[model samples]
Target: MMTMPSAPQLAVQASVKRADEILVVDDTPASLQLLADLLTEAGYVVRVAPEGAMALHSALARPPELILLDVRMPGMDGYELCRRLKAAPQTCNVPVIFLSALRETTDKLRGFTLGAVDYIGKPYQAEEVLARVRTHIDLHRLKTRLAEEVEQRTEELRLSSEELEEKRAQLQALMGFMHQVREDERTSIARELHDELGQSLTALRIELSWLRKHCAPLGEVVLERADAGYALVEQTVQSLRRISEGLRPGMLDVLGLCAALEHLVSQFAERTGVSCSFSADADDYRLPENGAITVFRLVQEALTNVARHAEASQVSVRLAQEKNSLHLCVSDNGRGFASAQPRQGFGLLGMRERVLLLGGEITIDGKNGTHIDVRLPLVKGE
Candidate 1:
């Protein structure tokens, strides 16, 4: 026997079959009614919004998968609506289709930038509307499914990556121990070469001199050549000094981090006429070795980018410590860009990765000027 279906059961089945909710936003009642009838007939649950304000409210209330937006509404037109919608976290993922009378490329680009899925002009054909709506619904479904899969895969990958990193860190610590031992061995060898072998060579030279005095009438040319040979030995000793310095900078050992940074800035400013200026209130005694180098490299990259892209005559770099966070800011008076635009290049991307590695954040923007801000936290063990 066939039992009649319950109202809730039927509703659930209806919802399962129809996964798309389309919002038709138009000011004209006639246009709204026409689009509503067409979409309703095409197996879609349609809601009509007479104005942009009503549309935004209704969209938040219902959260449509696809929005058919009109360009020329009374208050808060479609372009600005799209912009605000894209900015909001809840509505950013919702695909928008601009149905407008405006036919300019600039208008289309503006709509696209504001996260519009498609732009349909006025006097849209019935088949065209049906086809476009169907295409967008399918596209929206695909995107939603893809996002879910990506998120799931990302979570799994994150767990796997964390395990892998733990293993890598263990190996790195072992390798670090080995490296320290190797460095100690090298230091001992260097001392031996300079102390024992060097002393032996000096003694041999003195004995040669004594032999030269005993064996009289040694040619002047031979003595001059012997002096040149001694000069060569002195140059070899100088080369050894340079090699020792390369293993570890003596400036870092003797002058401290601030002096090293000042020397770096001096060299950077001398090469580029960007008039780089720095300000610090403290001795930067809080930052560890890695933290100090990170700050220095951050400024270095910012200035390098300025020299290449900023084309400005002057630049300013500042570093200050406040509480647990250290702030670094670099600004240049070049042609600024619209901060609202999506990122296009990778210079900032690399910098962001570097900051994130140290559990910090970096911001690169072109408002009044190209501004870069990096904030690094001084953790207990950091």
Candidate 2:
């Protein structure tokens, strides 16, 4: 049994086989033999066809690097054959040089218009023929090599683009999982504070109240001390509630996103003394739990930034649903910073990261005052 050649062996064989093939088409036997001999002596593989039909068949079956065609053949002439060769995808790139007795400019122009590369007068000199043949063959080979390089580069770019897109998707998924874990931790902490610390404080306040009311026999100073203790315990309980709410707002879970946002805006105005207004198209937007929390946190961060950075008198936040998307805009009439300078704080960066994880778009414009606009799709891809 004959063993098949290895891949490396085949590659080596291809590399060593560098001879170019030339096809000569002429009705005259002498002319065909003469050109064939000339090309064969120059270390090229030459194929001779007595007529245009045979030449076309040979070229199509196994394409050659170049063709030396006689213009005045019997049936299918040189111009017609050139047109057919150019029309065929297989032989279209093969260089064709026409041989003719006619030396008129019109004759050469006709040959060129049909896709012939060069014209050789009938009674051509051997030296001129050899020079032109070598030049055209080299040019054709260079063109083919460049085309292959372009195709290879195009394939590399396509693969690179696909890899980049895959990496981006993986990063987004990781960030989203991290956000969910963070939210779960916050909820657990909030629940612990509300149930344990809150109840204990309330019970202590009740005990102090009982002592102040029932123990009248105690001195005035002792009774006053009980009252102060009861008041302090009450204040501590209220502060605990505020802290728990900040961690995970009860309103967001119970009353939905719109109500939670409204309550938040009311508290911000009361605490900051800045005129803050909130408006929505509908009472309840009916969003998924994660989506609702994402929107609420985004707005919360925006308000915090305004209070800290924006020295604005008035702020407006609007929420609306347009078809399949949710739109939110937060604008303030504040002393905006220079647009060219980057934001020094992590607030904006965190907001951008959160939006990208959810496959949303966010734009912050600090032209007149700070303006943050966000658009999110109702349905997100995993």
Candidate 3:
């Protein structure tokens, strides 16, 4: 009757059949031949080296799947050779096993400390050698696979992050172009309203007055209707002026950022009755035209939010210049929301996009009151 090989024996048989190479380093010819023949008959390709230097040379030339080293060799012993093998980058990952007659626990411990995968006592058993060799080769292969997988994952994450950043940049550029288009449209519409509709209303009001003066004979009822028509025309002209200014303030183009912000704050105060104060570091210092327009729009949106949502009575707007940057702050003592709560409206989002387009930052804090702080670089087209 024939006995079946155990699981470990089976694994060794399977691995050896694949022709995995094993390096044997021993000083004694008898022991070296014994290990070599035993491994060869078991179906592994075996190579023998007389001492540590020859073993290291053979291993470096073409690293084996496993190394069986004699601990008692003269000069460079197994421990020293193991250290050298581990230090060299190419052979560092190869599994090493120590062979020795030393039964002391310290001797075995020293081998393990020097990175040997296993230590076998000599007079060695053939089966034990084959089993340990098989176990370690499997572990080394698994470790290599895992390392490769990790490296692949890291590279994938790096690429994904770069792609996301590029998309974000593209979105910001689109927003900036749209913002410019909208500003140009507003300027055109405002000009049309002021120059075309405003003039027509004014001329009609003058004609109504002339008609009333020339036709007093029409009596009190006709005179009263004519006066009513004149008043209505005057009211329409005022509305058109207000709407045009709101669309694109002509003062912003003529007077620059500081004057425009002052006018905006004054109007907000007068309209909302929300005690507002405006201040600036210098009246003469101004940003480029586009930057000034963005800042003015930022302040305008902030004040609108405060009036509509904050329900606060006191508001303060401040502008300052520092080195190459312009800083603007808008704060209100109103019914503030939680800082963690998300802003649901497009106003804050638009303000943030506008600031970012110019390579700036905006932060909104809603603690005791809502506070918006913005920093913009003064560089052209930044």
Candidate 4:
């Protein structure tokens, strides 16, 4: 009874069959027969061609796994045939081993120049021929496999890079939307504080002043209490204004980005005693609403960071326009941290996001204290 072959037996059979195909081209019938018999006995499926033309026709018809080409053939020589074979895309990768009587260095170099993988002398041993043929075939197969793997890996890397970029863009859009929402909320709250709460506090202060003026003659304790109440109301109003401005400065919307940035620098100097100097070359320049807000917020955040972390005595903020781009730089003589260190706070990240959303670039340098440089394209009508 016949039995089915095992998995290992089947694999070995397939490998042998896959590696058996070879083409032998020679002008001499005896030499062709000898090479064919040697390869066929060693389990290779060999095809014999009398000349270079026949070899080319056979290869183009059905490309063999390997070709043993003989030089000094009639009509077209082996070198010319090898060059032609290599030039053709279909048979360019097939390994060619030259079997020739010429053992000179020039002859070998000519064969190699024509893309031959190996050269054998005229009195070639069957074992040497078989060994060389096996070596080259294995090498060709390895080279082909490596090329396939490299192509696959390159494609995979390209796809991965595309996916990563897509994800980054999505994240950026999400962050921009969140920032807008936050700003809107801040604006709403600031308006409520400035209009409603501020007015209420002002009314309360007026009523207390009237009470102090009229009811002060009633008693010293009553007058003192009235004065204290008026003072507390005044402090509340001042605190409310400060809180509202901190949340979302009305100056930013009313006075535009440049004025808002100047105000910010002035406030920072006043509050932190940092001796900040702000200079702008394009004082009349204006930006789109979003761009203005982005610039204002970036300056605000940077100044806040400087106040909180930088133990600097002086800070310089400069704004200029060159050609079609706007440039802003903030530098401080602070005890700066390592710029290469991973940023830990949301301040720098938020600033970066804001700049990126505006199609701008920002760079931070800590080599000479902390320097933040921002470049933004000055869009027309903005």
| Backbone clash count, each prediction separately | 0, 0, 0, 0
For 109-222, candidate 4 gives per-residue lDDT tens digits of 999988888999989899999999989988988998999999999999999999999999999999989989998999999999999999999999999999999985799999
lDDT of 1 by residue, 193-237 (tens): 667866766776676566556544678777666666666666666
TM-score for candidate 4, residues paired by index: 0.92
How close is every model to the real structure, measured as TM-score? 0.41, 0.81, 0.84, 0.92
TM-score: the better of candidates 3 and 4: 4
- Candidate 2 lDDT tens digits, 143-233: 9999999999999999999999999789778878988999999899999998898888888988999999976687888888888898999
lDDT of 3 at 184: 96
Model 3: per-residue lDDT, tens digit, 286-334?
4554788898889999998988899999999998887888889999999
**What lDDT score belongs to each candidate, Candidate 1 first?**
0.73, 0.86, 0.87, 0.86
User: Which residue pairs show backbone clashes in model 4?
Assistant: none
Segments of candidate 3 deviating more than 4 angstroms: 1-20, 33-45, 102-113, 117-131, 209-220, 284-289, 380-382
State the lDDT at 118 in candidate 2.
98
Off by over 4 Å in 2: 1-19, 101-114, 119-125, 207-238, 335-350, 356-359, 379-382
| 1 or 4, greater by TM-score | 4
Kindly report the root-mean-square deviation of model 4 from the true structure over all alpha carbons: 4.9
Report the Cα lDDT for candidate 3. Answer: 0.87
By TM-score, the better pick of 1 and 3 is 3
